[model samples]
Target: MLSLLTDQQALPEPVGPLTMFGPDFPFAYDDWLAHPAGLGRLPEHVLGTEVAVIGGGLSGLVTAHELMKLGLRPVVYEADQLGGRMRSASFEGHPGTVAEMGAMRFPPSATALGHYLDLLGLSTAPFPNPLSPLTPGTVVDLNGESHWARTSAELPTAYREVADAWEKALHEHAELSMMNAAIRRRDVAGIKAIWNRLVPKLDDVSFYGFLSSSPSFASFRHREIFGQVGFGTGGWDTDFPNSMLEILRVVYTGADDDHQRILGGCQQLPLGLWDYSPGRMAHWPEGTSLASLHDGGHRPAVTAIDRVGTGFLVHDKEGVAREYPAAVFAAQNWMLLSKIRCSESLLPGPVWTAVERTHYMGSSKLFVLTDRPFWRDIDPATGRELMSMTLTDRMPRGVYLFDDGPDEPGVMCLSYTWNDDSLKFAALPADERLEVVLGSLAAIYPGVDIRSHVIAPPVTITWENEPYFMGAFKANLPGHYRYQRRLYTHFKQDGHASGHRGFFLAGDDISWTAGFAEGAVTTALNAVWGVLTHLGGTTAAGNPGPGDVFDQIAPVELPED
Candidate 1:
């Protein structure tokens, strides 16, 4: 330990507020969207031209919605319901209390998503993450030992040690404070200079390795404890072994913590964009929205995408086909192989490898509506809620509480697990899964009576089991930095070797940062720029997108073999 009495000092403090987007591209698009000059408008000639958007999720919907504003028609295609991973299911009778089946939390710094939230007139409150400001208290159960605390200060010594070490690691080792300051100022040169230096060092390193190298976590015990109870975003055990870059992007961006959720559900953002009437529009009559163009409906799921002449032909699930001048694929990258019949010519070998190898992290959530905030009833001896927002080193990794009020029904996420933990329940039925979760919770809180108060059956989903979404979101693995570089830069130019111009790709997977909605919105915006540019439109001199200035501010692209 560096206990030098001669040069001694206290731990260094974090420099600035949180405002990062991803590992690279630190310039905030949230600031760009707020600028007086808007995203570039399409040239007059291409105003009414039709572009096909495959997928109706947040990415696809945002693509279509923005195209309308720039004077283009987007024919959206979807196989299932509109909100892909943003599904919100309400208890049969209690419409007021609903369960967020997917994408429950939103980070405050996700201003790209916030732009839509503000425009849609949606309201949000602090999400009740374990040990988060919104939660009155938190309960951490590890190795059959339960610790209850409102803050890390209130937890046991070991927990406090882990928390303090993480804070120091982020500030000194990860350079979180400096990067955050640059991002806040939208300092393109400064952010790139700092982030580019980090890429080579962190790219091939495992997140666990990154932590182990830090002075504060030199031993396995500290690293192990840190993984079991990561400060922000719950247990990071799943991502501990992933690429350090993945962990850096997550922790740096506000995605991992200080989150909020739409009052009703996060799905409303996409659903709201569907019918959103743009204050300004192009080529259409006075009032226009993605909904009005599609007659308030989306085309069937696209089964195949083949290049026809210079354009692309997309076939629906029923084999119904349509042709468009250009196409923006907004679905998960895996869909290109398993679900959609992709043309080999559409993507050359390298890009196809990037798409095929894009790793997705699986996730599962079990939700149940209770008669009331049953956990709120305090125990005289413990002086805490029956259970704190629970996080355990057990089968059910993280548990969240959504308290509507004491009078109204409250929803509790009995279990939210990721990766292999989620895969374990892939074969389990809803009832069986519920039993497994309740058993896990019962083990975590031995004396707590959680079952008798159940008001209705639980809602459970393992995203990996769902055919449409093979996994939760992209969790880039070690040495996959090149793949992300390839995926994100593919849309910037049309003249690739494959003669595959006008076929743009946009989604969370294609963004610099994966998993978060900010990435989804960023990629969608990139595709919009690609679409407009492909249709002979040019960005205004004042407003240039990431694609417009990709060269100077481009993140460190790993050298190809």
Candidate 2:
């Protein structure tokens, strides 16, 4: 964001703390959620009251963690593992060897996740993104050609042209330069001024349209090349059909850059939260952690949710039914239709539509425990390392290497494909997928024999095919902004009058910034505020949660069709 602020010239510093959401939605949630003072204490009457938390993902875990601090008992239910899409699967025999089938790289700008990360006392290093200076080198494979470079200067003329054009287009077409400045300074008004204009216009336009419309990308070839070899993550063609607003938000928020992976895996953050004892507690006994509260495991998956008097009745897969004054539905929205039976009247028609219409993109990742970081070895003939962090127009869209140590062992993500590319291997067995990936890598690296380095069977994941996660992450399609808005601000609606007051929604799917841990954390905070107020609690005098000032800060809602 700072880079954009000083693109043309520098801006004077603001007088005080910069607020990002402006006065209308005037709350610094990232700060408030992690505030040293806390998100206000619950009333004595509500303390220790049990709240049913569906899905034991990060959202549910964080909600349970925070609510526990304020003296509340959270009964969590998860069908699969503790971490939902934040999963990091370890290799069969190798203890520390792991593959991040879900979220691998996390951004620093996502302060909410950062807060929990800091609390857990975890460490991180820059993810070796393709063509990133953080790594030793990068390999770019495009249209049957390959380029090796430590930076853009070493890449071929076409690759550099595409990269420069994209940067220029972001500044002129997307107003990125100005938006970055506003966001960096925490100038809410300035952000709103730039974002409001882009939101309305960009929400309906496809990313392809935005690029084609840009004069900076004069050549169609450059546009296609730009999509295939994107500057940061690479090949956003799968996302070309998505709204331009989505791309802009990703770039503007730094979600696609300055990424760092958890040292062991991202899963440690949630699992750590479950075990870390807070400074204070409200129920049972002091020094009780979430793991201790549940006796080291989560409850069975929730099977049904129905309105029952002032509270709601929740039935788990084990046929046990319990009632709570309030509940947080932290699972994917699709679960409401497939996995769990939700009462028709639980939410209004618009809210239901938003949930049902929510789009999740498919993704596939193949990880192999390698003998060493052999990709960094120099080849005598080619004058290039045996390989570099690769980005290709081929099926293997992106490849990353996780180097534990020079000699110990390393993990290489052979292929990470999204959307259509992922769906290509939806039905293929792991062995078959490995074969296909090996073939692709062989083509990219002529005689390197990538398979010789593989010490164990490769691990693969196709998110959509997984029953627990129908897709990798939530993505907004073109013309779906209204549906997104409804889900994003569903808590502000008449939850009680609409028969949904006690039932709340929280997850990355329900937030404005879908598919990021930040979204998951932000929405969980929103649910906490909802449950707190519903139970007659209030934020402290100095600190205000989102719900406390929602009327002013609510996202701009487009008129319903």
Candidate 3:
């Protein structure tokens, strides 16, 4: 009973329960990480060898941590800070109030990521998404009209119709129920059976195109409404041009459901891993950790990579060059095309093509620190909360209010927009962005003066403008599944030439489901296994890694012709 809006209260738990087990490449990554047996082992000679890990993001950190545990030295290269997009920018005066610049919300279905959070002893609370039970109330504004509703049943007939149409379309076209059940039970064969069939059929269909073809969404009005206020989250019209297969991947795995935000910010995950020492390590001492190994710092940005004798030569921005037997490139793959100089022999032809073809979505967010939880105040006339989690078709697109306590300062994400909508705010400064969003909110709450509650200047970020991250996240467009497949499968290097075997790819973009931390963690594990195998290592007996069982659970191959 995974409802379109991801209301956990609406459904009872099944036996196994659904996780982010994947509809494509449905391997039990969570189980793999939780197993008592370690991920894998390395040979004695290669134990202390250095392996260059480009990018100090989540993927690179995970790769480095695991490699360190396996007795290999991981030299991590970073262009910016340690926590890549998991940036939490705090107000100048407010101690704990922070605006999540990137990757704010997460779904419980991301079990692989949860494993690390549990390890780090981090806690999560329900995010205040539109219509989520954790939210006090919600406001829906469309076409210069506003409606206040505490639940989905209270919305107008048109909004309810849009919700129902979306559910029906997913059920009829995407095998929603069957896929969910299969994922819950970890039925690998069942997932492959369904996804393999859908991949070929839906690879060329856009998300917008799918809605147009569905009988339940025949009306242009319903389709437009659905895009403006999407289920699980809000305002996914930005994703309309993406492949239907990409949409299916997200929905099938429940990647957008039951969202939560990490307490003390998600940046702590990588930072914690960096400083944490594994209780059991192969060749390294018990107290040795990634932080101790690096002597409290990492190398600068990697500038170039070239082929050496049975290894690779990596050049950093500081003019330092090091040769290693193997390397893992965990940055945005597009960096390989422009920012970083990668030898033509570093990857296969199809993989380089995939890297060049990867499509990323642009996103922008405007946040401000408020004096207090002013939104919780009730109006005398309407008996409604002064303000609520909002979704609209205006420039703001979505507004989420975060309340720590009644006495503590509150944080407001005044606007969160994506794609073309995001680009509209790209040229605006923080103050201008705040003015535009506040103006939009003023129209919805006529008598309420939201600007008066602000205690500090606004904070904003346009992901497309970041030098390290050219865009927010990857979203495959129609017919780009083939390109995605090539990038994802590059970790299994047996098919590639010897020269391409030493270099591996790992990142959310390299995963089937991008924009989720779970993808980042799972792909990092894949690269760890790849690096282990490259050095003539093997997984512990009875604990097969993703690469060990490659032939059986590999992603389905669609004909290029």
Candidate 4:
């Protein structure tokens, strides 16, 4: 019998200082690059460049790649390593398999991303189909008793409510196509109007509250399952906080098979980007800082750009400094606010405060590598396949699943989720935490001897503690939906005006498809187009028109009950 563990009290407290990034974390990539040579000489020459991109993550990288294609030399600056939030780790003991500690799964409607994969010559396979109702997979309650929900259709009423919301959210806010009307005409006012009407609804109310309050939302018996599955407000806090209508717009616009994992790992995409860059665009000399205005009117902007005059000056954790005429402010909104010394104060008081106070939920993933296929037991009565399980808690909603091992059959991956409190629990000593997790797992699956089967120390990535990324992803606060209009609108306005003339903003936070990889790529493409148009490039015209693309794809068809 397979059971799921669903008690927080049983879990051990997390150990160590909450590893969050602050002003002290290195902001300039050159700092780390120069550490080997002990040479920290900053650049002083004016190297004319059309644009400077910051943050080597998908957004920055894709933007740079597009710029390069447009015949412009766009320099990229990464504060730490590439692949911003999409970081993966391979344990020493577990050689072939890898675990994603950061971003996971991509949505289907990401056409540009598909193009990116094609560019790198990477082929994708369908995600492993989840277990069907015939399998007796367990769903644990707060008391540690487990009950099985046969299929997603058989989920408890509460679970259904949340799932309904998820399905609704997906169809509503799936892609950028919904915003085509405003984007194509650059109708800032129209977008703002739509945003102003939506922000107030997201304040304070958790996802649970939204469903419960909605007249159209049907109630369910296992409402708590929503939290367990990480769907509702606290469970799955997305970057976009607009009204349900706007959120639904995103869901309906994007592709259906959007949720997919890369065959090798997320790292392959970035490494491929680095490898593909031409000699002129790829590697830069170590310890050589891009020129700044202070040296000779040749300021090279760092990741979070603040202001620019004769040259460019960007301020990040590295302190307020100037760079050459080109710079990229790739840091998050809060980070950008901290570094950039804006003369006009592009961000308003309320918006700035919201950005500062917004609390992002915490998340962590554990990849377990085994020498052999562990779960091969057959259920005599149902004969259904079981690949994963979901555990519920009174407080934190934790989800875990077994993924195909990278190189071999026996290899597997496990992932977990926790809110702020659960994250605090994760701070306990490793042994203690391990014991608690294993204890929980043992309760769910009495057959496996977890203590004896351990092959490697688990690798954990705490998004809450990451300096550059303050939290896993953005979530809608109580009233954030109302402010979202102003937030996105002003973000674009302030981003462009920050410095470097045509510098624009792109990322998960800014896009309507927030909290997904598709959002990141969509925004990056938009920012690139903006940059190209500013640079007098005609590539935008050469690219397939959004309308043409939209017309080619058939509309989604929902199944009948």
- lDDT per prediction? 0.81, 0.80, 0.89, 0.47
- Pick by TM-score: 3 or 4, better one: 3
Error of 3 at 520 (Å): 0.3
Off by over 4 Å in 3: 1-13
| lDDT by residue for model 1 (9-41), tens | 253553544554545865457766776667777
TM-score of each: 0.95, 0.95, 0.98, 0.68
Clashes of each: 0, 4, 0, 64
lDDT of 3 by residue, 181-285 (tens): 899889999999999989999999999999999999999999988898888887678899999998888888877777999887888888999999989898898
lDDT, residue 275, model 4: 53
Model 3 RMSD vs true structure? 1.3
Model 1 worst lDDT run, 10 consecutive residues: 1-10
- Candidate 3 — what's its lDDT? 0.89
Query: Candidate 2: deviation at residue 267, Å?
Result: 0.8
lDDT of 4 at 492: 30
The top-ranked prediction according to lDDT is 3
* C-alpha-based local distance difference test score of model 2: 0.80
Off by over 4 Å in 2: 1-26, 493-498
Deviation of model 1 at 335, angstroms: 0.4
